[model samples]
Target: MTEQQDIQLTFEEIVCACDNNIDWVVSVIEEEIISVHGKPQQASYSGFQLSRIRRAHRISRDFEASVPATALILQLLDELETLRKGG
Candidate 1:
């Protein structure tokens, strides 16, 4: 993958990119619904992670799913995409 596609972003950047609030992001982090790659005090995430954050936030908000439930749904979606790609 290109560096652009794999670019890393700080938590705040992810929030703006995903249009999600910091509290929600922190909540997901605490729930382990997604992850970051830095110290706990300054966690950073990849561009792809921003995509997942967007999807998870939207899914949870629109469908009233809990963080764990949303994570499960996203996992299933990822599996579906992987299967479609024969990966």
Candidate 2:
């Protein structure tokens, strides 16, 4: 099987991708909904993480969900996907 490389995005790029402010990204990081590499101010995220960020932002915006709630929702979704993959 061929291997695929995950794209990494900087803090600023992540914020731009979500079209939100830095505070939002920081809050997600603080909540541990997503993780990063490198220094705090210079953190970088994988493309997979970027998908999580976008999902969390949409869930929060569309349902007015709290960060913690969004985190739980994302976890459940992750589990479901894993099951679908028979893992």
Candidate 3:
């Protein structure tokens, strides 16, 4: 497999590792917890978004934030891609 293919496989692996629901994913994006540029920044994601989503889920689970878990999960996924692309 090529380097690009390996990266793609890694991304898929990360996505599969995420166990949160869609609702949680949305919250991550809405809360703006993770960003491509940095924190407190609104942006979109494109690559390695799955990894970010997983991280967001872990944070919410660990902190027990007031926001809905599902929403946060979605947001994390969305922002993750944007952050990964650095756009």
Candidate 4:
């Protein structure tokens, strides 16, 4: 498979493992604004998108920023992934 295809497949796997409410997942992706190559970008996430969202939530919480519950959901999703990975 091509590299892009591999990435897409991997991302889908992550989303499935996320186990979050699908509607909330979609909202988080829609609301999140990210920078790619110094340009602002938006993402359309599948279930795997939760991994990145969760990471962002952790960083924000560590900095003591009050992220909303939807954001916190990502944090929980990440923790679940870590446990599943046995790391």
| Number of the top-ranking candidate, with lDDT as the measure | 2
Runs in model 2 deviating more than 4 A are: 1-3
In the range 2-86, model 1's lDDT, one tens digit per residue, is 5545787776787775464777777777776676565534876776677778888889889999878888898899899999999
Q: List TM-score per model, in order.
A: 0.72, 0.81, 0.38, 0.32
RMSD of 2: 1.9
lDDT of 2 by residue, 1-87 (tens): 999988978788889876757887788888889976655469768888888899999998898888888888888998999999999
Q: Write the per-residue lDDT of candidate 4 for residues 1-87, one digit (tens) a residue.
A: 665432332334433443533443344455552212221123333333444656654555466543455466655766899999998
Which scores better on lDDT, 1 or 2? 2
- Rate residue 57 of model 1 by lDDT: 88
Q: Pick out the ten consecutive residues of candidate 3 with the lowest summed lDDT.
A: 5-14
lDDT of 3 by residue, 32-55 (tens): 553444321233444566565666
Per-candidate clashes come to 0, 0, 27, 3
lDDT of each: 0.76, 0.84, 0.52, 0.46
Which structure is stronger by TM-score: 2 or 4?
2
Ten contiguous residues with the weakest lDDT in model 1? 32-41
Candidate 3, position 57, lDDT: 64
Which TM-score value belongs to model 1? 0.72
Cα deviation at 45, candidate 2, in Å, is: 1.6
Which wins on lDDT, candidate 2 or candidate 3?
2
Q: Comparing candidate 2 with candidate 3, which one achieves the higher TM-score?
A: 2
True-structure lDDT of candidate 4: 0.46
